[model samples]
Target: MTTTAHTPPAETPPAQAREQFRAGLRRPTSGYSPGYAQVNLIAVPQAQAFDMLLFAQRNPKSCPVLGVLEAGQYSSELLSGGDIRTDIPAYRVYRDGELVAEPDEVTDYWRADLVAFLIGCSFTFEAPMLEAGLPVAHIDQRVNVPMYVTGTDCAPAGSISGPLVVSMRPLPPDRIADAVRITSRYPGVHGAPIHIGNPEELGIRDINSPDFGDPVEIPEGWIPVFWACGVTPQAAVMQSAPELAISHAPGHMLVTDLPNDQLQVP
Candidate 1:
């Protein structure tokens, strides 16, 4: 069954949004819990923790580390009262580097030797962009942002490394500069556009077809802008082929209590 995009009520609190997810609301989190930060999640065995940390360090643009929870810990001090295992809408389980299951909750798969990493997501910046009157196409279309695996290769670190992944948004030629300026204030999120215009330059053969997430309409005179994605780490984990790894399903994120302005650069 195809799931239509549904925007969460404007007054919904972060806790309420998470409660909805905990109650089995499996939907893309693009427009939920307005003004709160949303994060990407990846849980790996402690044995692979060092490599994962190095991977994030080497690819800061794509894998900006937000918080790291020690082995078996589910809650994050950075996001007070946030629980990692049950807060997200959907979870992807990878066994031997292949996706094995997409579950609503990962409580059953939790292991004492697992370490969870929270990565900053671009979704955190969309609010400011919208406030600035810069159009966010996917949100308008009620779909997930389009993402692609780029030809760009991330710097290798220990056992983890892979091609950079990017999320795309089409902006009016006139509004592109303003969009960049608005997003540049949030370095804790994705920061700014890594590439603008010409998907072919990024080795994306078809702009209409994306490696992850759904495609949105690119109106006439709009140019595609690409931003570094937190999902890059998932691609790296897939390449590393660890014994077990867990991540949020594409477009599903861990909504946190931290406000979006908290991530703005000084």
Candidate 2:
């Protein structure tokens, strides 16, 4: 397995982070360059672009589309020359919607008909959350945020539809309001908590066992807060079973030139 067991230092710039991934450093990108924004990646055949776009439109919270690249184009104008095929620390290749391999790079999977979509990531709000004195468990623990498939279904668009997915962070009951206030400012990044408290309410049978990413322990008096996640699109793709699709492995996002503050709304 291609493992993201190590990451570039927090002081590393976005370009250098990309360089590390390009050099085969496969590590989860939770705290790399704190102020920079990170994005979830999804590349699919151009033939399915319209449906994918429509899907994002219908399910904006879970699939907030940041930008979409032209077929076969790997660079994004929004991300400052970052190559989609090599900039992310890890990539997952899905054939007929089933994940086939988790690789450090996807140059061999590149094709002329593939169009890449950059989606907003929840990691974008962590810097602000931390600044506000709230604890983000995954970052403190150095693990991927725990994610789960929810019972709620996303609004369907063409052939793209699936259960909503969420990332969980355990927050103290008293600080939940502050966490909400801070994160709600960044709607572009899957802002705010979609659910709070009981995990079973969201069809998550085992809070310790997430559908994707790593699990974190809930400290005493803390409640499990859920946020709509970019991984939702990958779940939708798997259900729709597109011929081929590629996504940033959970927690391994595409770091961009855009600052996190730029994504904040009034």
- Runs in model 2 lying further than 4 Å from the true structure: 1-8
**Clash number by candidate, in order:** 0, 2
Candidate 2 has what TM-score? 0.96
What RMSD value applies to candidate 2?
A: 1.4
Give the per-residue lDDT of model 2 (tens digit) for 1-266. Answer: 33334433648888888988888887888888888889998888988889988999898888888889989677866667678888888899999999998988999988989988899999999988888899999877767888999999999888788899999999989999999999899888998889999899999999999989888988988999999999998999899989999999998899888788889999
Q: 24-127, model 1: which lDDT tens digit per residue?
A: 88889998889898999988999999989888888888988889999967786655675788889999899988888889999998898999999999999999
Give the TM-score of each candidate: 0.97, 0.96
